[model samples]
Target: MATPMLTSPLTPRLTRRQLMRSALAGSTAFAVMPRPGAQGLTGPAYEVSAWTGPVSGFALVDTTGKTWRPADLRGRAVLLNFWASWCEPCRAEMPTLQQVADLYGPDKLLVLAINFKEPAARAIQFAKTTGVTMPVLLDVDGRAARQWGVKVFPTTLTIDSRGRPRQRVQGEVDWTSSAADKLITGLIQA
Candidate 1:
């Protein structure tokens, strides 16, 4: 007989206290600076309506070997960040991302750090070295990176609860800025 593999739920259930902590952390980080623009981060603004492609509901493995999917993020705002261990700018912006994840609360907003073409071991090492707490997903083949049109390192694509890409910030950004919190909070409410 073949062994069965139990599939995990799309969204993990988190307690109110945990949610509050994450939100507080994110807010405090955003208070430190202003939100930077997305110029030079990606190719172009992907048409909102054109988001009907295969990129929807994609899944990737996190640092802990758990699977993360877009479907799991349905009710929350999401920031899908494509990065790599070797990118200098990517390394520079990790703290802001950590703050953003803490501020938004996992229940209301999920930040998925998708590693482009990097080994899982390297990704894990990077996380430990940088103290990044956001879930880091591995894109070993760079398929997701190519699909999402990530032309540069540290491109951030903010997706609303409906899974539509709202803003594409290319290049490094101060993830903890008030503008970023306002935008994320607005999206969560929207």
Candidate 2:
């Protein structure tokens, strides 16, 4: 017998607009706030809301057995990517994410791949097969995801250098794209 997976009825329903946005593979989505000093820029590749939650702290362990928290990552822009091994879109955008991580380096930016409710072996194997060198954190109980208000797979939270939550992207994004580069560059420079 298998245990039944349950979901909260209070989980916020996704709007049709959101469904459309997430439908586009490798599309970037975030709040439509005008980036300061970014004049004549086009809209985001997709659309979603900004992060409006506490930026206080969180704790999760990486595949290498190291525990991490926000305090441990201050003075650097952090991209907390919530994903699961079975999610196709999540797997698809990973290489581009690695590219972004390598482009910025560990000092300027840290991209943590937070695997949702999966075993450590699974994430490790996926990282090994995919050659993702970034820190792959495990949310084995899904607590970190819930705390971060991630109701969707492949959601990414961007934290600026000052440890401020900047954007909440709720879908797959081609991190190598110009739009992604601009957003990440702004975070690094902020």
How far does residue 115 in candidate 1 sit from its true spot (Å)? 0.7
What lDDT tens digits, residue by residue, belong to model 2 across residues 32-85? 422223343223333455675576667889999999976877999988899998
At residue 9, give the lDDT of candidate 2.
73
The Cα error of candidate 1 at residue 57, in Å, is 4.8
lDDT (Cα, 0-100) at 156 in candidate 1: 73
lDDT at residue 44 of model 2 (Cα atoms): 36
Per-structure clash totals for the candidates: 8, 0
lDDT of 2: 0.78
Which residue window of length 10 is worst by lDDT in model 1? 40-49
Deviation (Å) of 142 in candidate 2: 0.5
